[model samples]
Structures are given as structure tokens and as C-alpha cells.
Target: MAEEKPLTVVTCTAPVNIAVIKYWGKRDEELILPINSSLSVTLHQDQLKTTTTAAISRDFKEDRLWLNGEEADVGHPRLQSCLREMRRLARKRRGGSAGAAAPLSLAYKVHVASVNNFPTAAGLASSAAGYACLVHTLARLYGVEGELSEVARQGSGSACRSMLGGFVQWLMGERPDGKDSIAQQVAPETHWPELRVLILVVSAEKKPVGSTAGMQTSVDTSLLLKHRAEAVVPERMAQMIQFIQQRDFEGFGQLTMKDSNQFHATCLDTFPPIFYLNDVSRRIIALAHRFNAHHGKTKVAYTFDAGPNAVVFTLADTVEEFVEVVKCSFPPESNGDQFLKGLPARPASLSKELLSAVVLEPVPGAIRYILLTKPGPGPQPLDDPNLHLLGADGLPCPRA
Candidate 1:
């Protein structure tokens, strides 16, 4: 038998980003261009992230994808868009060089395997992390470099923001071609060391209305969405940037909550109306407001995406107390140790005055679990061969 062809493989991980200034609608569906500029904080990858591996070989039959161990369609329009763009860019780069030998042949078919550490949907910015990891891994496999936010955006609009670390903003470019509509880093991950994030997973199930579908409906029907995109977001983006730059938690937290509320309100304004927030979600919002009121300041702020899950932002000093308050409000079914995951938070006791001030009936099992994390860097490549998600034969390795 002929010698087996050599395979080139690369593995990388990308972090999820929670939008402070939300991107609710798109101006172009095909290009995944956002209607309004949005800002987001990239969550620490150690707690929440997507890990992806890409391999290319001449023996492979076709371009294929495996997500979370199961095979996924490679022909998905958005997936196809990302694949086509990366290959086109690689081909363009190869053609520009005179006599230099290319590292990998562009003719080889690719197999990609990706898995998210956290829930896939359930409004966790899973698509952003998944697509960012996909593009980042593929870029390494093909030796393509430079700005890749545009390519990632085609897979998922919020994904562009995942291309950078810490605070990021996606500029809703006026260009019809969308070349200028790319994500830019407002600050590095180290910019706000005291900032903390708590993800309260209300439900891990897939959302009833997908973000893409929901956005389209909102764009088609909601007048509020149009006004928010054109009028509100422009000013909010500027103010948000200043707050982050100055390390102003109160301004940042308040703006984050308002933006999230407005986004959901726009959803409600949709023709038939869409409801992503359930009873549990509403309770969490009330708890957050009451807790902040008891502290006589914005001690904690909450933001929800397209699903019922809540992302709470606060400073490092407030994490323990806020986490304690969350537990008291929504008692977890699991043990206290099991209830909290990721970065550790010391146990805190609520005073009688504070407890009475923020009085609310405890809702058992309302929150599935709490993941504690902070701002972290963007997509990172894995250096170890053992970490590759795919085996030597271009198939996914069995989970350990």
C-alpha cells in the first residue's frame, strides 16, 4: 500500500464575550454586518470557552465538521461563508509570493472538531466563541494571518468581538461592502483587573427562538430596534468606552443593565412578540436591583442575552457578597461547594439589615449553577500534540 499522506493539524481555544452594548440586529444577513456598534467583555477561557481543532489532508473525502463529538453539516450557509472566505484569503496570499514554497497545500480537504466548555446556546454567546475558535484554528492550519475579525463575523456577528481580548467593540461600518465593519479592541484584558463576571445559568437548553431568526423578525417589524440602532447605540458606545477607560464600574454597570433591558424590550416590540426572559430570569433581575439598592450603589449589575440566563458584572470586592445574595435568592439543588464553579468565591453571610432590605422569597433550583470568571485574552493556539481534538486519521479522538 502507498504511504499514508501526512496531515497538518492545529488546535485553538476562544473565549465567550458578554455584550454590554448589545448588537441586536443586522443590516446585511449574508455578511453578518451588525446594525449598531456594540461593546463586550471577554470571559476568562479557563471557565468558559470553545476549543477547536482543524486538520487538512489529501486523503480526506470532503470538508467536514464535528461539533461536541457529533458530526455537523459543513454546508451550513454561515459555515460555508467562513470556509470560502478563509480559503480565498489563503489562495490570494499564496499567489502574491513569487517563488516561496507554501507551508500547506490549499487543495487538501479539512476536518474540523469543536467543543464548548459551557452550554452551547441558552444565550451564553456560544456562537461567538465557537466561530472565533473555528476561524482562529483554521488560520493557523492554513498559515493565514492578519485581521481575521471580518472572517469570524461572517460565521457569527458577535464573534468578531471575540477576536480580541478584554473590552472589544464591533464597529457598524457605513460601508455597503462591510470591509470597515470589523471588531476593535477598546482595551487589553489587563485594563480592568478588579472587574468580575458571574454567569447564572438558568437553562442550558437551546433557545426557542434562535438569535439570527429573532434578529430578522425584530428588524422586519420593530420600530424600537431601528431607533435604538440609529439613535441610541451611537451615544452609548462613546459613553461605554469612556467608562471602561476610566475604570468606572458604576457607569459601566448601569449602562450594561440599561442596554440589556432595552435589547429585550425590542424583542417584545417584535410583531408577534418574543419572550426570552422567563419567570426565573425576571426574579434574578429583581434580586439584582434590590441588592444594589441595599448597598446604596450599583454593587452588582445584570445583563441577559437572547435567552433567560443572566450575566452579572461587579467589582472583585463585591463578588463574594453578590454571590451570597444570588444563592440566598435562588437556592441551588446541588451542594454549596458544587453550586459555585471556576474561580473561587469565599463564603459570605448576609446581615439582617441587608437581608430585610432585599427581601424576596427563595426560589429553589432557579439557577442551575454559577460560573465565576473575569476578563481574559482572545483566541489562543494549543502547543501540545496531545491536546488535538482530532486523531491522526482526521477523526475526533474519544473523550477521556
Candidate 2:
């Protein structure tokens, strides 16, 4: 290894997405292939996202990874898959014999450093953002590009969705090689410019049961999961797509809520049972329904993943009213918790009658904060070196 070897580095940021059509089970564990195609709205980078930097150099003796300012397991199968695939593609596309990808140091080892703007493993899909950033950033360094979501899918199933903007669907393709299973854009960010996603961070602490293990158990044990994947998903996916195309918030909200409920239902149907939603989650569900009923339509929709947080979806015109409903109902500053954050919106007062009609018990402590955001772009390059997460020494840098 040459101590003075120059390095090639690239850094990029990838947004986090919340599944409206949840992916709960996997048919192939090794490849991280999903049993059903899932759809999600890619969030704006204003709130939750992951930033990663990939540095390749002859001086580096081994490949290493750092996540959120801490050294992570570079040997992780998914991480290795992303790294290996990038190198393979680079070698095949650019590198020549003896693994020379370019005129320079294409065969050199890489050091990856990633950091998330949000909590990890709290069912906010940190892995999705992290892996997407890794794959995108690595591709930038390797000079291999075009539809890299398929490669990202090998790392984390949902991570593929982050590869595109706005509404995305990970098609559960028929091919066994998993080549056809890729993320595709359903609609661009401009399609639903009025739409907003308000994430209620219930518990930022690491999930007691990770999605990987929980979904694995569901695949092995839950017959409901099997039925849902085989019978329920295809039709639901079609309906969801149509709803988005038509901008049918009422229909979309109804289906989104139903799909989330069914996803959790499959969780209960699993042996020994897994509960992602607690009292707070259940209350949020009720509130969404009652709030919609008060207006006689679905003004906002609520969805939950394999964790307790609630993702509330609504339109821009209605966002302020709903945010006030949530704040007045839950009180963000209560108990000294500064929980309300995201998209600047004025507080619209909820009627005393409306508040009474909501008929929900308040549990402010259960919710950590509310993140306000909208749909935005996919993985984007950081042109400025000031934003890079890796140091010139090919090591992790202290976060600003």
C-alpha cells in the first residue's frame, strides 16, 4: 500500500420514505427480496435523510464503514453486497483485466462513512436511507450509474424506493434472478405538490424488534402474511396506483389506513405475536378517522410501520388545521418536550366542539415530536466539500 496514494471520493444524500403499502415479508432472505410489491412517498430532504461519503484509495488496506459517527460492521452482508456490486459493475463497465477500472486507482479499497439526520432502527426506515446513500455514493465514485435501485434492493428491500423521487413502487417481479424486481417512479414530486407527510416520532429509541427479524418470523410463521402477499397485495397495489394517478385523497387515505391495519393484522397473526403499535398509535388512528369524519372526508391519513411512530399524510391546505389539531390535542411543549418541528405553518384553532368530538385521550409523552415535510427529490450529490462526511485521511469526520 502506498502511503501517499491519492484518493477518489464522492458524497451524496438520500431521503427516507414511508411505505403506504408496507412490505412485511421476504421470499428470499439472502437477496432481501420482498414477497409483495410496496409503494411509498419519498420525503423531502428537509427532515430525515442519510449522508454518505465513499473514498477509494490504494493506501487503504481494507474496506471499512462508519455509521452515525461510529464504526459499523463492514462485514454486514447487505453492506458487502452494495460494495461488491459497485466494484463488480465498475470493473465490468470501466475496470479492465487485473481489476483496473480506469487509468487511475479504480481497484483500490474503499472507506464509507454514513450519518443519518434521524434516529436509527426506530422503524423510521433508517436502513432504507443509509443503504440508498451508500449505493448512490459508491456508484458516483465508481462512475457506474443508471437504475441502481436494483443493486440497492440487494442491500435493503425498501432502500430501493429511496432511489427515485415522489411516489415509488418496488415491483415484485416474476423473474427468479431478482433482476426485474426494481423500484420505479409512479409519479414525480410535482404531481402532488400539495401533499405533506407529518411524522409523529413516537419512540426514537432502537426498536426492540427489528423489521428484519420480525419480517423473517412473519415469513416463516404467519399464514395471514402468505395470503396477504399472494391475494391482497396485487389488487391493493393497482388501486393505490390509480388513486395516486387520480389524486384521490379520500380513496388513497382509506386504502392507506386499511393497508397499514392489515399489515399489523398479519403481525398479530404471526406466532407469539409482534405488536408495533401501542396505545398511542391506536389513538392516532382513531384521531385520524374522527378528524376525517368531522370534515366528512379524509383530510388526513395515518400510517404506521413496524414501530410505534405515526406518519400522518395530508394536503398543504389542510396541514395547518391538522397540525393544530395534533398540537392542541397532544401539546408538543408539554412535559418540557420540544416536539413540534418541520414546514413552517401557522396554528389554526380547532373548535371546542371539534376537539370534543375527536373523543381521544391525550398522551403527549408517548409522542416525542412531529416532523413536518413534503415529497421531494431522490438521492442528490453534494457539490460542496464542506458537506462530506469523510476526512481526507479516509476516516470519519466529526459532524458539524
Candidate 3:
């Protein structure tokens, strides 16, 4: 009897990172090359992350994907690029084996299954987390090992940093080919256990300008972005790294807020002026400043990405105070019935439904709800067979 063909399965997870020192203005858009170095902290996976399982089986017809339990287009260049790159790396493995026995060069077709803990198109860098998870999982399934930072860079520039846990830096390598452009860790999650991050989801709607388009706009027209890349960022990168190393919350907090402001300033300075933040976002920033000023130093540091959502960072000691202060800053929602019904704050696992009632925190209806988290770890494979996309026979399941 002929032996059954081999099958391969790989699973990986990635956490979302909020840039303390932002990455804006790409030098090469195709390669996702950043004009300046940036730093970010990986958020807790239980709070926000993407887990993906990639498998290869001869039984599969073509490359396919199921994202968050729904069929998604795998032909997208972003998805195609990651799939092709992982396959290339897999082909180069020193000792390749699908199910043992033979040194298989390429034995099966690919299938990917992924899920995100947070809402998609919510301006939470879901794409960064998604792509990073896909590349890492595919690499593991094919018995291929390479520099994770390099693999992630092909997915997303900010994604390279998501490959690692704790505080990471995406070094703006000057090399044109982007070999030197990879993420390096400044500190591990354990290094700063006292820090806490609260994600205030201002809106679940997709940002009008995606990061790629926003970066391009800033690069082409914003003179402030030019100045930031050349003069401002290099100095900030060094100080930010030192701040992380020393666990200096005040120093880190100041730099984070400043960099976030500068990033959006470049957005406003764009030719047509892409506005990612609205009145609600402005109110949150102002409230943070007021609270910190009242305390005589920074108690809570707030940063906004390409969207209106606010990521508030505070030392564990000050979180409750900051949250309370922010709650009072905005007027109650105008809708009488809805205004009285406070937004629920609970873990996602405990709740079956997505938080639908939008409570106006400080800026009425500005924030959807807040996700509480802390520094977290990098990718890990899930042990549950239920999470596997491949069947016991090492073939893609039709249901997957």
C-alpha cells in the first residue's frame, strides 16, 4: 500500500503595538520603509491580538483564508506578498520535512485561518497584527526559521515591531534595500510590569485615510514631516530608548504625547490636510493635558494613531484617577435614554456580544469603550486541536 502524503500545520499569534514614538512617512512605500525610527509597546494579547494558523496540504486546491470565521479575499497583494514570502523561506529550509520520512521541497498547498480579538477597521492597527500573525504562522508550519523582524517588515512596517513582546524599536535603516530596517527590543514585558494601557475606542468605523495613504500624503507634501524625519525623530528615538531602559514613566510619557502630536501635525500639514482626529479626539488630548498639569507632572499620557481612538498610558498607581478625570471632562450624551444607560466595562471573554452602546465618556459619544491592558508577549502557538485549520490527515478541512 502507498504511504499517505505528509501534511504541515503551523499556528502563531501577534499582539498590537501602540507607537509611543510614531512611524510616519515611508521612504519606500512598497518595501514599507520608514523615514524615521519609532518605538512601541506590545499590548496584552487577552485584550487585543490576532491568532493565525497556516497549514499546507496536497489536498487543498489553492491558497485560501478564513479571517475571524468568515471567508476573506486571499488574492489581495498584502496577503499574496506574505504568502509568497513565507513559501520562499520555507523552500530554503536546511532540513525540510512535512510529516517526516522524506526531505520534501514543497509537498502541499497552503491554507490560513485567522481571528482578531478586537474589532476590524477600527483604526487599531488590526492589519499590522493580522499580517504579522500570518507570516509567523506560515514560517513555523513549513519548518522555516528566519529573522522575524525581516519577515514582518514585508507585511507592515509597524508590524516588524509586533513580532516581539515588550518595548520594541523599528530602526530606520539607511540601506535602500531595507536589510538593516528591522525591529529590536529595548526591554521585555517583565521589565516594566507596572505600566498599564487603556485603549479608548472612539469609533469602530474605518479611518477615512489608511496608514499607507496617510504616510504617503505626509511624505509628499508635509514640510513638517520632512523636518521630523531629518531633525526631530533621531534625537527622540535615543531618549525614548533610554527612558524605556530606565523605566522612567515621566520621560516616556512626555515623549510619547509629543511624538503623537507631531505625527498628526504632519497629517494636518499634508497638501489636502487629512484629518484623522475630530472634536472628540481633541477633547481627550486636552483633558489629559489638564489632568497632568493639575498634578504638576504627567500622570497619564495619551496618544492617537491615524484614527480618533485614544491610547492612554499611566503608571498603575494613577490609572483610576486618570479614568475618573477623563469621565468627567465630556458632557452627557444628548439622547436622554441612552445617556442614562452607562457603557458596560467588562472583559470580552465574559461578554457574548460586542459593546454596542456607545457611551460618551468625556466627549459625549466620542469614545466607544475602553480596553484595559498591560505590556505583553510575542507570538505563541495554540495547543488546541480545535484551533488547527488542518485535519488529522494533514489536509485542509473544507469547513476551515
Query: What lDDT tens digits, residue by residue, belong to model 2 across residues 1-400?
Result: 3224588778999999999999988888878789999999999997878988988888899998888888988999888888888878876775444653353355578898988888899889899998899899888887786779999999999999999989999998878888899999999989988889999987888888888899999889999999999999999999999999999999998999999999999999988799999888888888888999999989999899989999999999998888777776676546433566877877677788888888466765667788999999899999899888788898877772
TM-score of each: 0.98, 0.95, 0.87
- Candidate 3 TM-score, true structure as reference: 0.87
Which candidate ranks first by lDDT, i.e. highest? 1
Better of 2 and 3 by TM-score: 2
**Local distance difference test values of all predictions, in order:** 0.92, 0.87, 0.77
Pairing residues by index, what is the TM-score of model 1? 0.98
Candidate 2 residue runs with Cα over 4 Å from true position? 1-5, 95-106, 333-337
Local error of candidate 2 at 386, Å? 1.2
Query: Clashing residue pairs in candidate 1, if any?
Result: none
201-257: candidate 1 lDDT, tens digit per residue:
899999999999999999999999999999999999999999999999899999999
CA deviation > 4 Å runs, candidate 1: 1-5
What value of lDDT does candidate 2 attain over all alpha carbons? 0.87
State the displacement of the C-alpha of residue 358, model 1, in Å, after optimal TM-score superposition: 1.2
